[model samples]
Target: MAEVMADNRVAGAKGDGRFEPIEDSQARMLADLYERHYEPIFRYCVHRLFDRTLAEDVVGAVFLDAARTIRNFRGSEEDEYRRWLYAIATNHIATHIRTSLRRRVLLQQAAEAGRLGPHDEPARTDGPEWPQVWRAIQTLGRNEQTILTLRFFENLDFASISAIVGKRETAVRTMLCRSLKKLRTQLKSVFDGDR
Candidate 1:
């Protein structure tokens, strides 16, 4: 398509030899950013939500918000852009959790009022240790959960995570250390119980 070719041309062009509209440049940058960063963001969301469809929807929403705010985005470096995008994804996940909690509360209220029929019990897990680990992760405070997931599951270093989380590197390291210690303690108890 002509649009694709135009985008490619503008994207590959360095310096201001040719005049490209501001909108065109921003669009090209967004497309490039999406191509490079979408998978990592999607993985992060999937890890947080444990639902592929919801993760995909959240990814779409994250990019949509990024595109809208791209004009205000600063820093031309890849790492800075990554931090910005991850920050957006982090906020979206928080919103998703709040909404889910609100819905659950409303459903519970409805059931208590006798306006809804009884529902089946939640499913039980009978899988490997990873599922148990994930369940234990849910018991952590929100900050602890986010730090552990970013550090371990996403394989991000403390420096990058500090940027995404808006925390000092030292603070991030401290929280990560505390979170890992707590997680190890929790896992030990589970293994002890199994024996």
Candidate 2:
């Protein structure tokens, strides 16, 4: 319990005070943060990039950036840290997409390839219908994909997803509903052999 309290205190301290902890606590917090959110962030990245390796790199970069900047973090009643962490993930994914056209092409190619290797597959979405579902998700605008990933897979509330994606909660909800409808339509077409 002391460790949790200390962590809370450390998180709440303002200015440079939060950076005062020795490297050990810093490392511990980083590790704890990774343990808590790595999978969700990775899933978000892979959903965006469609490549396991690049997704892993993006997730690593997100957490590394988080570790370096966490001292400036402010406290919140909700899972603020998790939201902040995912915001970093979202930014890293966007930057990667902007910087690497070839990488984006390769990722899209892999997604179209339909192999679903060991790691890149969505958990429950991996059944016979997965190919259609994934392809539909890939078709979404990047913002829609990011919001859907945060809302459905990460189980984040609309407000937190709005904060992450820089939209109003109502907009997030509308976009998510639209994205899902698009997916349903695409999946129906796929199963109907429209492709």
Candidate 3:
């Protein structure tokens, strides 16, 4: 009888492993992670790319990458997973920017073959100050823009931004301050021109 009971318990365990019902635990875990991080990630991407579609694409890719690699994640008390996720996002954004710039260059070359006119002027938007601010942001160097995005849009601390960008915390802070000053100067020029 004892032998039969032991066999039954083993079989039950095997069946549980093989054909277990879907549990809400994993869903809750994923939801919690997404809820906590999605907005900041999306904002970071949007600020970097200045396009909603590209931001959405990058954010989706980041989450997908996280899901794929989650199995290897070891449980930790520290928020290591968030840091890892941000690192992945930073890499993805960099790759996307490179590929997009290459494509833009190719498109420009192709269009030049037909002797087309210069590219049309950027569209005017409704916002009074935001468009000017955004245009000034575009003038910043890539690293400056990245530092600004991570610092302001993502609301990440210098340490977190440093971790993402593989720089020292002090360096990141200095970069952010310098970038902000540059942006301010650019915006001033824009405003001066508008007057």
The whole-model lDDT of each prediction reads 0.76, 0.76, 0.68
* Candidate 2 RMSD to the real structure: 7.8
Clash pairs of candidate 1? none
Error of 3 at 21 (Å): 3.5
Model 1 agreement with the true structure over 133-167: per-residue lDDT tens digits: 66567667777778888998899988899988889
Cα lDDT tens digits, model 2, 51-170, are 778899999899889988877787544378888888898899889988997866665566567655456545444233444456678788989988888877778889899988889999
**What's each prediction's TM-score?**
0.72, 0.74, 0.67
lDDT of 2 at 186: 66
RMSD of each: 8.4, 7.8, 7.8
**Mind giving the per-residue lDDT tens digits that candidate 3 earns over 93-130?**
88997888865344345433433222364534332344
Q: Model 3 lDDT vs. the true structure? A: 0.68
Task: Tell me which residue pairs clash in candidate 3.
Answer: none
Which residue window of length 10 is worst by lDDT in model 3?
1-10
Q: Candidate 1: misplaced stretches above 4 Å?
A: 1-23, 102-128, 189-195
How high a TM-score does candidate 3 get?
0.67
